[model samples]
Target chain A: MSITVAVDAMGGDVGLDVTIPASIRFLQDHPEHRLILVGDLPAIEARLSALSADARARIELVHATQVVGMDEPPQLALKNKKDSSMRVAINQVKEGRAQACVSAGNTGALMATARFVLKTLPGIDRPAIAKLMPTVKGTSCVLDLGANVDCTPEQLLQFGIMGAELVGSLTRRERPTVGLLNIGSEDIKGNETVKQAGELLRGSALNFYGNIEGDDIYRGTVDVVVCDGFTGNVALKTSEGLAHMVSVFLREEFTRTWWTRLCALAALPVLRHFKARVDTRRYNGASLLGLRGIVVKSHGGTDALGFRFALEQACEEVGSNVIGHIADQVALQLEKIQRPAVEPSTTPETL
Target chain B: MSITVAVDAMGGDVGLDVTIPASIRFLQDHPEHRLILVGDLPAIEARLSALSADARARIELVHATQVVGMDEPPQLALKNKKDSSMRVAINQVKEGRAQACVSAGNTGALMATARFVLKTLPGIDRPAIAKLMPTVKGTSCVLDLGANVDCTPEQLLQFGIMGAELVGSLTRRERPTVGLLNIGSEDIKGNETVKQAGELLRGSALNFYGNIEGDDIYRGTVDVVVCDGFTGNVALKTSEGLAHMVSVFLREEFTRTWWTRLCALAALPVLRHFKARVDTRRYNGASLLGLRGIVVKSHGGTDALGFRFALEQACEEVGSNVIGHIADQVALQLEKIQRPAVEPSTTPETL
Candidate 1:
């Protein structure tokens, strides 16, 4: 059976220009895959017309009149964006029309729509979004980049389980080590939520690596690092900012000294290869896990090539049977498992 | 008439090897300055003997028998470490015998001791640590980096004022913009702490840059970024890790192909220059602000040279008279300020 990736053709600015072509390119590169484009028939067609004739035949367009605005209120959009390409894309996966859905849209909206349309997987309390980050040694999977800002102890534990399963399937590691992102490596450091999360994670079968410090993220210390979206997002942003800052600084420093410039001349070959590994585009598409169907959220500002790269990643997710793998793990770890009695509250903690 | 920096000579591993030599270099470099090294006389004397004979006459040592262990609790250490190099260092500043104190020791103990000895300025309830992070545009100061984890509305407002003044002192920018790190650029999205702080910051005279997303840190969008210690520590660590990751990855990428290797050689000059700009050693000292005196804390793992850098930084802070400037500003901005009629409770509300 061939893999099918449903493209949300209406969300991002580059959706039409980039997603369609990238989808075509990915399909061409992987002949064992089928493509289903979900969006307005004509716009996608106009964009699709730009593709070479032979490649056009490999594409299939599923018309949907709705489009989820990239900036729509997440909650409100999920309720009303029933016909949106993002929702329709996920619906295709649910209907077995596609293997997974891919979109570069408002993160919250996509997550909300995914939860609403496809529903969370069995034994899953809430869904999480995991983004692949390029680390020093290899790639690190960072979860809850922006799924739920306020998660419970159980939710965090679920994230750890979910993240472990996802990384296990997608990466070379079979049983990836999971880390709880906290202020300190010691047990006494994190807030109450993290402390409780640690105890719960410690009990799970997933390879719990205990507490990991913020500085450990890029050190390639663990395969997976888990945190709520608020902290995770900040961490992600800080990383990006620092990366940019450092490179800029290095450029300035080397150019100032003629001798260092000579050293730079000899080091160029190794440096470019290293730069590619850390480039943000290398790990662009984020997996939307725990939802009923596979949905990938790519950066909204991605270019045509970036969109294509995301499409390639989506294909990898489909080809690897990653979702099925996660579902299996989720079944073993949580599906039939008895849940402890606990209060589920949505009120914010007063601090 | 002379600038004196109290050296916590008993602190860290290198002690005077790093401390004494750096101070000697500074005094040699600046003949206008004076030094009062505070620590055990015997150890300092043993280390001082190694210094050049000419440099010995310019230095002064004050004996203080106690030393604060890195593992000691902040409160207990402050109470018991009367003879600690940290205590004596701050005390020297308190007695107006020294203009600043520099230590590579237990940070919490140093903070507590400094606070205890120096006392908070009249309007300030707590002091903050300001770390100057290298940015695309030279550098930016991030305040409250692990000094205080959780902040109140009034406290955040004070941080903004404090951070603003610190930035002004370094960059001399009038009305330097202060950005409050948050989930989104919009003021509506953050937690209650951020929102309440935003309300307070907006009301204050300091230039409020509104919400700054995490990516803004490297963008050099603001002069000062203010957040509680918990978040600040996360940001700082994340940045450090990312920089390391980037350097490592660039090394890997540049070696993948001969052509890439050639590219690496070509880019070597640029990359080396980048390292110097982002080098943490250039910006390692964390200036203890809002204390009665200038107390700079160096990273505990620092080596002799790093200790020397901290010493140089301390001398600069003293010469700059940053503490006195902040003290004056606190008096001017806060003395006549009207505090809110209602006291905010510290109890966290569970939703």
Candidate 2:
């Protein structure tokens, strides 16, 4: 079946200028897949009118009455902006009008909207935002990138399982190795919650790689690293901060003197190549995993190329059946591991 | 008032190979300061015998029968190895034999030993590891790096207070700005713990810069970034990892072809200049603030030069009286803010 992605056209900093162009660009490459643009009708139509007639044929529009402000409270956005572009796009996935949804909007509102519209999968207490971060080797997927800040031990275990399944599907690794993010690699490290979660993951059927420190995220030590939203979000943002700082430092150093400027000229190609490898825009899309439907959150400040990457990520998830694959794995693992007296608090009925 | 720093001679990866030379080098530069080397008698003496006559005059060796293994449990190391270099060095600080202590040993053991021996100052429930991290502007001091993984809102506020004082002393800024690290900068962002800490900081005497996200650490948005130990440690390590990854990628790219290798050679001076700007070794020492005595934890794997920088940090802390400064500030802030019924649960007895 042809994949249909719901594009939240009114979301992000540049809104339709980026979304419409990105949808058009993505359609050119992905001829089989169609896009349903969900946003303010007049604005979207204005952008759409500029597109060629053939490009418009592969697109559909679902008008959204409201737009969630970037800084609006997630709860207020959820309650009041029922007809927001972000919510409407997610609704397309819930109602089977689209195979997946992509939005470059307020992260909190996007997560809240997706969770509310699509709901969680069976046996899942909470959904996590799984982010792909660049590493030395390739990239590693990290989960709970600010979904639920205070997660129980069981929820962390679920994140490990879901993250493992998602990475496994994307990378085509039979079982992606999962690492629990902590302050130290030792089992005795971290707080009570992390230690308990380690025990649960170790007993499960996952390819558990034990505890990993913060550096391991970029070291590419494991396929997936799992943590509560608070830790994961901080780690992710700190990396971004460091990367930006390094770039700024490099620019300042390369322009310090005439000799350094000449050196910069000689190293321009290598620097450009290095920039491509560590560019944050290349890793823009973050999958809001664990929901019944696929919803990818793009960086609000990203360009059309970055938005297209988010669309590509959504298409890949749809093709790989990530949601179904994770559900089956979660069910199978829970059944085998939950048999012992030390079962998780989540009841079988939840599964 | 000669500043005497107790050195854990038998700590870290290479032990005396780094410590002895670092101590000698540090003493050569700071003519007024002294170092009391604490470790196995014979081993320390053998290394010390190689030092110059002038260096030897300012150095004293204290015999410690045991050494704390890098991987030993903190509690186990504390109980069994009372005479360990790590423990003995801390004891020197506690007994006023030294003004400060520096160790490149087990972080947990160092924190545990220092807390048990030196104890926390009044109004300081727990000691925190305040780390100096490189930023675009210069460097920002972040705490608690790993001392208390699970910190309460009150403890976080105390971290902000202590961190502010420590930075104030080191940077010589009368009122160093403090930023509470969180997922977002908005008042509504972060979990309950972070939110409460914001409230406490806002109502206190600190130069609160408000909430800052991860990138703000590298952006040098504030002088002191305060968070729970878990978040601080994770953010710190993640930046290290990314820096390492980028360097690896740069090396790989620069050596990819003959032309690129030539480019690397041309850019060698610029690259070296950039490295010096962001060198981790320059920011080696981590101050274990909140304790009655001063303790600095050096990275376990650092070499002589890095160890020397850690010694410099210890000397600076001693000269600035970080501990006394923090104690006075904490007391003042507590007295001013504790009048409200919303006083923290930490009683005067605990303080």
Candidate 3:
């Protein structure tokens, strides 16, 4: 099955320098995929002039007169930059011209523009930013990274459902286990919203793993970790800060003297292997789940290689039909809740 | 002046094994300090039989008949375990027999009992847990780790003041910069409570650095980083998880094969130095701030070295008169807010 993805070519810190190259590389690697590059025509063409005919045949260009600034406010971007590259890219997804959209623009602006254009899935009050994080056993999907600072218990339940569906589709897992993020693992922990969310999750159709602490994210104790955006964002950013600091500390120790530098040279291969095991670029894309169409947000500061990983992520979501799965799951859950007289033996099996 | 700290000898995972030796080491190191060991007489005597005469002279044994289980609920521990080592240790502070208390018991029980015994300072609503985290520049003090799940705007302002006072007294920095932790550094970021807290911090006499993201905690952008307990707890635990994962990855890479093992041996010294730089044991103690008396909670799973560090922390707090400083700071801020006619030039100087 062929998938088409719209790229915000004029977005991110380096604009065309990263996006254009990333798009060309993705097209070359994915023969069954096509891309619509949305940006300034002259600028995009300048970078793509060296592409082969086969790659050019798989690519389309859409002109956008404006570009959203990396630090622009979300509300202003949504209201004023209607013709921006980010907006045009999302429009392709809304109009069915592309199955998914990929952007490395300002996160707030991307979320606002995409939500404005594509709307949200039915029964989902708000869209959440879900991202894959590296864990000891494997990767865990955590949601609401920074989309909504304050989340209702119902919204958290929706996030759990959407997260389970996303994981199920991507990994072909029949029933992914979901865990509510809390300060403690016990039932009587966290704020009122989280406690209420835990009860809702326990009674839902999804496989609810009890409450999990922050350390459980790296432990890979559950497939899906759900929390309010404020907590999730803080956890994610704190991890990044810690990882950076450790690397800096390692560098300082490795170069303290000539003998230590020599030892570092001898251990270079092992260090490189360790770095590859926890590379952030491999997990560059964050999906805006619960949206009507698939939209993946790349890290704004990433290079072409990292942006290519994001494009690949978009293609994977499109091919797996994640949106349909989420919609079906939501409807099924609602039906189960509404039908009060249904017996346990007569209930339908979960997906 | 000699400062005496009450030690809960039957707390933590290792119980008497860790606390007794740690207390003996602490007493040997600080001749001007003393310890009141509270636990079962037989168990406490068994460990202290090997201590020197000089060390024994500075130590006092106060037998407590009961013990608080590590997993016991806070309310139950507070009500049922009246003569528990944890409770008895806290009572020493209440009865003015000890200047401060150190415990490695259940955090909830420690907080509940400490608050019940010491009560809160005049202008403080609740006690917050503040601990020092290593950062790129030096170290940043953050609070409240998990005391209150839901905090009001006024409570957050109180936390900022408490955090500023803690850092100021500990580092002797007269005026420490305080940063409100949020998802973004912009004034428009975070939830309503955080936004209001930011406004309050800015208007106060603190060296208010408007707002900081999670990364700022590690970057040491400010001396004191303040947040609601839920967010702070998640951030702290997430850092622990990430650091653990990285170390595990490094070990796997180093022991992958004989060649890698050889490289690891060659780089052992540099690796040890790196490990010591980011040692969690060195930063073991967490201060329960805003209470009328001093209390430090150690990690439940720590060894003798870590518990000794907690003892050192309690002694430092007692010597610095942290409670008095916090009370003074809170009162001064309250007075400034109440007297609306005080001009900026006529305002009293902050501690």
Candidate 4:
């Protein structure tokens, strides 16, 4: 049977300008794949009608009456707006009508709706949002972005397992090494939570590489890095800020003189390629793991190209069967968690 | 009256190469200042003897045979390394022989020694390590860098007061805004610890700006950002890693062509200025707040220039009476901590 992906048409700052065209482009390229546009019907159709004949023929629309505002609370909106773009998109996946769902809407709303529709896997406490942030090694995924803030040692151990599975499956790595983000690289550097978690990770079934420091997070040192939503969220935003600052500093330095600007013109091609290497857009969406169906939350400020990338990532996750692997890993880890063994605590920093 | 600044000549990777020379430089620049170099007297004196005529006349050496290893546990070293560079440095400050102590040794050892010799402020539970990191809006100070992990709400409130006092005294801002870093910008998005910290922050008398996201930290949005040492440590390290990545990316991007190299050459002056602005050397030291006498820990890899900058920073803190201000702020905040106070139960992610 042919597979279908649901696109949240009304989401993101630059709505259908890129979304509609990108979806059509994807369908034209893949004959077996289909699209279910979940947003305003007339608005999408009105935009599509203006496109070429081939673009019009490849599109289908499924109306989602309400749109989740960027500022609205995710759980509140999902509870109140049953037919919001976020909900409709995930519902399409939950109902088995679509293989995966992609949304550039509120992360909270997307995560909340995903939990309700896809439901958590067996033995999973809470779902976490995992984003593949650009790092020195390649790309490293940091989980619990905002799903659950106060993660327990058990949750962190689970995150390690799940993160390892995702990283190993997505990247061409086998049994990737996992590191617990801590203040220092020593085994005895972190707080009580990390200390206890470190013990658990040491004894767990995964390829735990002991503790890593915050500086080690984006160093591409580990295959999987796990932490609470608060720490993970902080790391993601700090990286973005640094990246932004770097770009600002480079541009400022580049335009310092007339000669420098001329050099900028000559080396624009290489600079463009470098920018692509560190481009956050190419990283695309954060997968909401521990859920039955694939749900990727695209960056809120995503462009058409980013949305297309998000779609590609969602399809990859479904095709890779990472969820099944995570389930297997979790099932394996479950046996160890139940054992009456105690491990000493250590974090990334003091390892 | 002569002001004394004790220097740990046997600390850090470069040890005397950076610390002794930097101490001599500081003394030469500030003729009124008294120098008491703490370490192996012969080794420090040898380095001092190599300095120019003017610096030698202004500098003196105090012998301390022990030097704490970077990998040693702080507690064990505190117990055994009684005559270590860190202990001797802080001891001089405590004995009224020096007004402040500066070390580029093991941070934990320095912090431990400062506490052992100088003691904590009255009614203070623990001392915090506060750092001044480069940000878009010039720079900002974050406290409890690696001092106390898994900090309680009460501890976070204390961190806010001490950090605010330090920032205000150093940055000279009337009331530096304090932000409780968390996953979201809302009043209630984080776990129990952060949620409770928010309540304590709001109840306390410091100038709190509610909750701030990770992205806003580097934007210079808040002057004193408060969190548990675990989270603070992660944020600091992550920011450092990102900054390093940015520089590396630029270096690689600039090497793309000969024209880019020419551009880099022409932009060298401006780039140097930019580099100096964000360089770790300018803000190499982290102040150990709550100690009776001023103490600063320079990075282990710090060079002579970094050591010089750290010595200058210690002088500024001493001259400004940063700890005295923190003591005064603590007295004010202590009264607020006693009341049933607003419940600190709401996490940051919920807000």
Candidate 5:
């Protein structure tokens, strides 16, 4: 089966420098796949002049005159920059020209444009940003990283269902364990929203694993960890800050003296092994789940290798029909509870 | 000037095994300081048999018939266990026999008992848990770590005031910069509560540094980081989990094979330096701020060294008069706002 992905080649910090190379490498590796590179046509052509005919034949260039700034507000980008590469890429997915869309552009603009163009899957009140986190056992999926500041209990249940479907389909797990993120593992803990969400999760048809704390994200205790965006965003950023501090401290210790530097050289191999096992590049892609079509957001400052992993992530989601699985799961859940399925709204909430 | 701290002798997971030795070491180090050990008389006397006469002269033992279980409900412990060691230690502070109280028991019970016995300072709505977090530049103090699940905008402002005063007095900084924890640094970001709190913080007398993200906590962007208990607790626990995972990953890599083991031996000194720089025991104690008396809660599973640090934390708070400073700061802020200071209520909110 051939799968086509629309690439925002003019997005991210490095723009064409990272995305073009990553897209070329992705196409070379997967001959059964194709890409529609959306950006400035002449600039993209300059970068692709060195490619062979066979490789060139598998790529399509879509011209985009405007580019979204890295700090552009979501509303302005959605209203003004209609011809932006980020918007054009999402249009491909909306128009059925591509199976998925991948962008390393401004996250807010990407989310706003994608929601405006592709809309959301039926019964999903809001789209959630789900990311794969590296865990001790393997990996876990955590959602609502920063999409919604405040969430209702019903919205939290939707996030859980979307996350569970994403994980189950991608990892081939029959029923992924879902945990409600809270301050404590006990049922009687946390604020009113989380407690209510726990009760709803327990009563749902999903495999609810009770409440889990912040530490459980990396413990691999559950396959899907669900929480409101405020808590999830804070936890994710805190982890990043700590990780960066530790690395800086390690570098400082390793170069404190000539003897220590020599010792660091001797331990280089073991350090490399440890680094590979927990590389952030391996988990660069974040899925914008609950949308009508698959959309993957890559980190803006990542290199070609990191962006390639994001492309691979998009391919995996496409191959597994994540959107279809999530839609079916939500419909089934709504039916079980006898709740009426709401029609998908055209005007979605802005980031 | 001499400072006296009441110690809960039969508290924590290890109880007397950790607390007794830690108390002895603390008294030995601070020659001018005294301790009131509150617990079972017979067990306390048996542990003090080996102490020197001079050391024993600085210690006073009080008998308490009951011990609060590590997992005891706060309301149950407050209502039923009238003579519990945790309660007795707080009672010493209430009776003016001790300047501060240090415990390694259940946090919820400790907070409830301390608040009930000591009462909150004038104009302070609720007590917050503040802990010193090691940052890139020295250490930063963060507050409301699981003290109140739901906090109002006024309560968040109170937290900021208390945390700033705590950091300022402990570090001897005339004006410690305070940062309100938010999902983003922009003023337009965050939920309604944080946005209103940001406005309140800016309008107050604190050295407000606008809004800060979770990464800023470790970046040393501000001397004091203030947030509600829910977000603060999750961030703190998430940091602990990530730190533990990194150490575990490092160990697994070091002992993977004989060649790696040899490399690890060579890197032992550098590794030791790295470990010592980020030692969790160095920052063990968490202060319950806004209460009338100083109370420090130590980690329940810590060893004697860690518990002694908690003792040292209590001494520092006493020596610097943290509670007086907080009371004065809150009063000054309240007077400036033209708000009437409510009389201290007999029935305070429970955990």
Candidate 6:
């Protein structure tokens, strides 16, 4: 079966400049996959005309009259912009016209629209935005990037279970190691919510590695790190800022004098390799986990290469049936634990 | 008047090897400061014997019969180890024997012991651990590293006030810009605590800059970034881990080939400059803000250079009367806010 993905061509800062070319490249690379570009018809069509005939044949365009502004509030977008490219792309998955949806739109808008359109997987109270990040060992997935800012202990446990399922499916491992992102590794560390979540995780069936600190996220101490959306988002942005600052500083040093510039030329390949290892673009796509249907969010500021990676992520998730895996695992875990009382509460005030 | 600082000479991973030399160096540089080294008498004296007669005159040794282990639980250290160097150092501040206290012992133990001995300043509910971090624009101070893991909105407001006072005192700025760390700059972002804190900060007398995300910490967007202990600790450690990994990666790249090795030699000066700019040692000492008296926590794994920086931080805080400034500001802010009904509730469950 061919996996069809809806691309929000008018989304993100670059709009069709990046999304259109990315969709074309994705179609060229994966012949078995199909793409439906949702955006302004004339603009997208113009970009599509630049693609090869074979690539063009692999794609379909759905005209979207409205474009959700990057800074618009999620509530405003959700209530008014029904025909927005971001919403329309997600609606494709809702209507089963596409297997997955990819957007580089406002994260808040993307999350709100996708959740409203697709609802949430059974046994999953709220959908979480999970992203892959480069680590010392390899890549690790951190969830609840900005989905649910406040999470209960039960909700956190659900996140852990869903994270384990996602990692297990992606890595083809029976039990992927899961760590509760906390202040310290000690049992007595973290706030009450985290401590209670730690207890729940320890007693659960997951391959729990006790508690891991924020440093553990990059150390690759675990395959999945679970935290409240607020913490996860803060950690993610802080890492991005630090990574960017380091690059800027390194570049400043490397171009200080003629001799240093010569040294930079001599060490170009090593620098390039290092850059590739820590490239933010490589980790652009974020999985909107726990959704009934697959949706991947690309960074709004990403270029075409990054958009292509997001499209690839959508395709991979569709092929892997990650949504189904999480739904089934969560249901099974919920049944086994006999914690029918412990439903994943979606209330932020309860936190 | 000569400032006196009590040093936990037996604390940290390296013990006397780092502390003894660091104390001597600090005293030699600052002729007006006196240090009372609290630890095992013989162990500290043996290392102090290596210092010149001029350096030794500015130092006094106080025997501490017990030593707190690095991994020991804070509650255990507090309840059982009264004579531990960490406790004795804090006690000196309580007894007016020293203007400040410095320790590189178990962080939890230090906080617990300090809270017990020095207590919190008037109008301050909890003492936060604030540390300076390198940024694109000089450095910024982030607070509540791991003190109050779960905090109320009002407590967070108090933290912002205290942080501003600390930054104002250190930077000699009349009013330092303060930022409340959140997932987004929008008013709707973050958990209830953060959102409410944002409102409280905006309404207060502080130079509030609204919400700042994790990236803002390194962007030098504000002078002080206030957060709950749990989030602040995670962000702090994550930055540390990322910085360390960047250096490790850079070293690996610089040593990859013989040509790269030659480039490394040529770029030695630039590398040294970069290292100095982002050196962890330069930012080692963390201020235990909100306390009645000043206390600085050194990194447990610091070497002599790092320890000396920590000592300098203590001297700076003592000279500036940072604790007094914070206490006065908090009291004034509390009066201005007219929130006498809102006392800082120290319960994590309330979060």
- TM-score list, all predictions: 0.89, 0.96, 0.96, 0.93, 0.96, 0.95
Docking class of 4: medium
What is the Å distance of residue B308 in model 2 from its true position?
Answer: 0.9
Worst 10 residues of 1 chain A by lDDT: A335-344
Superposition TM-score, candidate 3 onto the true structure: 0.96
Indicate which candidate wins on DockQ.
Answer: 2
Clashes of each: 31, 0, 0, 33, 0, 0
Q: State the lDDT of candidate 5 residue by residue for B1-351, as single tens digits.
A: 899999999999999999999999998998999999999999999999999999899999999999999999899999999999999999999999999999999999999999999999998888999999998888999999999998998899999889988887678877999999998888988999999999889989999999999999998899999999999999998898889889999999999999999999999999999999899889999999999999999999999999999999998999888888888989999777544335554566792
Question: What's model 3's lDDT at B11?
Answer: 95
Candidate 3, residue A53: lDDT: 96
What is the per-residue lDDT of model 6 for residues A183-262, given as tens digits with 9 covering 90 to 100?
88888888788899998889888899989988988888999999999999999999988988888888988898897788
Fnat across every predicted model, in order = 0.68, 0.93, 0.81, 0.70, 0.77, 0.80
Q: Tell me, what's the RMSD of every candidate?
A: 5.5, 3.6, 4.9, 5.9, 5.7, 5.0
B-chain TM-score of model 2: 0.96
- Which candidate would rank higher by DockQ, 2 or 6? 2
Model 3, span B1-351: residue lDDT tens: 899999999999999999998998899889989999999999899888888898899999999999999999999999999999999999999999999999999999999999998899998888999999999988889999999999988788888898887887677877889999999989999999999888888888989998898888998899999999999999998898888899899999999999999999999999999999899999999999999899999999999999999999888888888888889989999677657755555755772
Tens digit of per-residue lDDT, candidate 1, span A1-351: 577888898768656877776776786777767788999998888776667666676678898888778767888888887888888888888898888888998888988888888898877888998987877677789988866777888789888888887777678588899999987777766778889999888877889899998888888788999998878888988877777766666655556678767766666545554555566777788999988778888888887667777777777777777767777777776633344433444456783
Alpha carbon lDDT at A67, candidate 4? 92
How good is model 4 by TM-score?
0.93
CA displacement after TM-score superposition, residue B171 of candidate 3 (Å): 2.2
Winner on lDDT between 3 and 6 is: 3
User: Runs in model 6 with CA error above 4 Å?
Assistant: A339-351, B339-351
lDDT of 6 by residue, B90-163 (tens): 98889999999999999999999999998888888888999888888888889888898889988899988888
Q: TM-score (chain B) for model 4?
A: 0.93
Give Cα distance to truth, residue B90, candidate 5, Å. 0.4
lDDT of 4 by residue, B48-107 (tens): 656777667666678898999987788988999999987888888898888888888888
lDDT of each: 0.78, 0.90, 0.92, 0.82, 0.92, 0.88
Q: Model 2: per-residue lDDT, tens digit, B1-351?
A: 679999999899999999998988899888888999998888878877777787888888899999999999999998999989899999998888999999999999999999999999999899999987888887789999988998898899899988887787777877888999998888878889899999999998889999999989999999999999999999988888988998999999999999999999999999999999888888899999999988999999999999999998888888887877888888988878777766655577655
Judged by DockQ cut-offs, the docking class of candidate 3 is medium
RMSD of 4: 5.9
